[model samples]
Target chain A: ADAAAGRAKAVQCQACHGLDGISKLPDAPNLAGQNEDYLVKALHDFKTGERKNELMSTVVKPLSDADIANLAAFYHSLKP
Target chain B: ADAAAGRAKAVQCQACHGLDGISKLPDAPNLAGQNEDYLVKALHDFKTGERKNELMSTVVKPLSDADIANLAAFYHSLKP
Candidate 1:
C-alpha cells in the first residue's frame, strides 16, 4: 500500500482521528501504530455490521476495499 | 481524582496501553486526551458486559469505581 496515497485519503478521518492518526474525539480510537491487519479487519467489520459502532459504520460505508487497505497502511505508518 | 495516584495504578494497563496512555496493541485504543466521561462510561460498560470485549472485560472486572475514575483522569491529562 502506498502510505502517501493513504495519507491523502485520510483527510476525512482527521475530524475524529487526527492527521497523525491519534484520536481527537473520545468516542473514537487512535489508529496510529496499530497493526495493519487489525485496522483493515476492523473497518471491514464496521462496514459489514460485525462490529457495532454507528459512527464507524456510517463512515466506512463509502469505502472500497482498496480504500480500507490504504487507510490501514496510512494510519499504521504513524507513531502510536 | 488524584491523577498522580491514578498514574501509579495504571501500571497494569501498560502492556497494551503505553505508560503515556497511547496504545501499543492494535485492539486497544489510545486513552490520552479522551473525554473523562466517555472513558469512564466505556470502562463501566466493559465491567458490566454492556460493551462486549473479552480483554477489556477481564481487565476492568477488578477495577473499583474509584479506580476507573482515577485511571480516566490520569489518561485524560495527556496529549492525544
Candidate 2:
C-alpha cells in the first residue's frame, strides 16, 4: 500500500483517530504503530458487520479494499 | 503485574477474549500481544466511563488497579 496516498485518504479518520494516528476520543483506540494485519482485519470486520460498532460500521461502509489497506498502512506507519 | 494471577482473573474475559487473548466474539478486538499501556488505559476508561460500552463498563467495574495491570500484562504476554 502507498503510504503517501494513504495519508491523503486518511483525512476522514482525523477526527477520532488523529492525523498522527493517536486517538482524540477516550472511546477510540489509537492506531499508531499498530499491526498492519490487525488494522486491516478490524476494518474488514467493521465493514462486514462481523464487528459491530455503530460509528465504525457507518464509517467503513464507503471504503473499498484499497482504501482499507491504505488507511491501515498510513496509521501503522506512525509511531505509537 | 502477575501473569499467573491475571490468568485466573481472566476467566471472566474468556467468553469474549480467548485464553490466548484472541477474541472469540466478532465485536471484541484481539488482545494478544496488544500494547500493555493501551490495554490498561482501555480498562480504566471503561471503569471510569471515559469510554462507554455497556458490557465493558459492567465487567470492569469490580476490577482493582492491580487487576487491570495483571490483565494487561497477561494479555500482552501472548503472541499476536
Candidate 3:
C-alpha cells in the first residue's frame, strides 16, 4: 500500500476529519495523534458492522485490506 | 464549549484515530497535531455537504455548533 495514495484518499475525509484527521468541528474527534491499533480497529469495526454508523460503514466497506493498511500507514507516518 | 466534555465524546474515536487522535495503525493518520483552523473547516465541510463523505456528514450532522467547538477545543488542547 502506498502512503501517497492514502494521503490522496484522505481528501474525502477532510470535511469532518480534516486534512490532518483531527476534527475541528464540535463533537467530531481529531485523528492527528490517535493510536494506530485503535484506527485499524475502528476501520475494521466500521467495515464489519461492529460500529453503528451507516455512513462510515459504507465508506469503509469499499476499501480493500490493502487500502486500509495504506490509509493507516499514511496517518501514522505523520508527527503526532 | 467544554473541552472536557468534548474529550468524552471522542471516546468513540479512540480506535484507528487513537485516544489522542494520532493513529498507530498502518496507513491511518495522526490527528493529535494539526491546525485548529483546518480542523474546524473540515468538520463544517462534512456537516454542510461541502465534502463528500457520507459517514462523516452523518456523524457531524448530529452535532450542534457548540458540540463541534467543544470537540475542536478538546483536540486543540492537546499537544499537536
Candidate 4:
C-alpha cells in the first residue's frame, strides 16, 4: 500500500512497463494512472492463469499478494 | 465526452468488455474506472497500429475521435 515501497518493488517491471509506467513495449499496456483495483485484479488474474500471456504469466508467478498490491499502487500513482 | 452518448456507442464493446466495462472475455482488460486519457490513447494506438492486436485494431479502426472520447468517459465513470 505504501507508494515508496511500491517504487522499490517496481524495478522488475521497468523493462516493459517503464519506471514512470508508460510502457516501453508496444505490447505492454501503459500502467500509469490505471485504477489500482483493476491493476491488482489483472495481476492476480495473470498469476492465477485466468488471464494468460506468456510473459505476464512468467513475470507474475514470483509475486506475492503484497508485492502485487505495491506494484499496483506504484503504477496507479503516476500521471498518464 | 458525453457519458450518455458513450453508453449508447458502447453496444459494440459489450461483447468483450461488458456493458459495465468489466471484461467478459479473459483476454480483454477491464475498462471500468480506467484513466480516461489512457483509454483514449489506447484506442488511438489500436487504430494507428502502434499497438497490434488483430481484434482491437479492427474494432477501433472505424471509431472517430469523439467516439473514442465518449467511450473513455463512459467507461471511466464506472465503478471498478
Q: DockQ for each candidate?
A: 0.25, 0.12, 0.12, 0.10
lDDT of 3 by residue, A17-50 (tens): 7777656465455665455555676688678775
- Candidate 2: RMSD to truth: 6.7
Candidate 4 scores a C-alpha RMSD against the true structure in Å of 7.6
TM-scores for all predictions: 0.71, 0.58, 0.52, 0.56
Model 2 pairs in collision: none
| Docking level of model 2 | incorrect
Chain A TM-scores of each predicted structure, in the order given, are: 0.93, 0.97, 0.83, 0.96
- Please, what is the whole-model Cα lDDT of each candidate in the order they appear? 0.82, 0.83, 0.67, 0.83
Error at B52, model 1, angstroms? 2.7
Alpha-carbon deviation at B45 in model 4, angstroms: 0.6
Q: Which residue runs does candidate 3 get wrong by more than 4 Å?
A: B1-76
Query: Model 4: per-residue lDDT, tens digit, B1-80?
Result: 99999999999999988998877865576777667776888788788876566788898988999999999899989876
Number of clashing residue pairs, candidate 1: 0
Considering summed lDDT, which 10 consecutive residues are worst modelled in model 4 chain A? A25-34
lDDT of 1 at A22: 70
Each candidate's interface RMSD (Å, one decimal) is 3.8, 7.0, 9.0, 7.9
Candidate with better DockQ, 1 vs 2: 1
**lDDT by residue (tens digit), candidate 3, B57-78:** 7778888877777776676677
Cα lDDT tens digits for candidate 1, A1-80: 77888898899899998999777876676677767877888788789876667687898999989999999899988986
* lDDT for A28 (candidate 4): 70
Tell me how many residue pairs clash in candidate 2: 0
Better of 3 and 4 by lDDT: 4
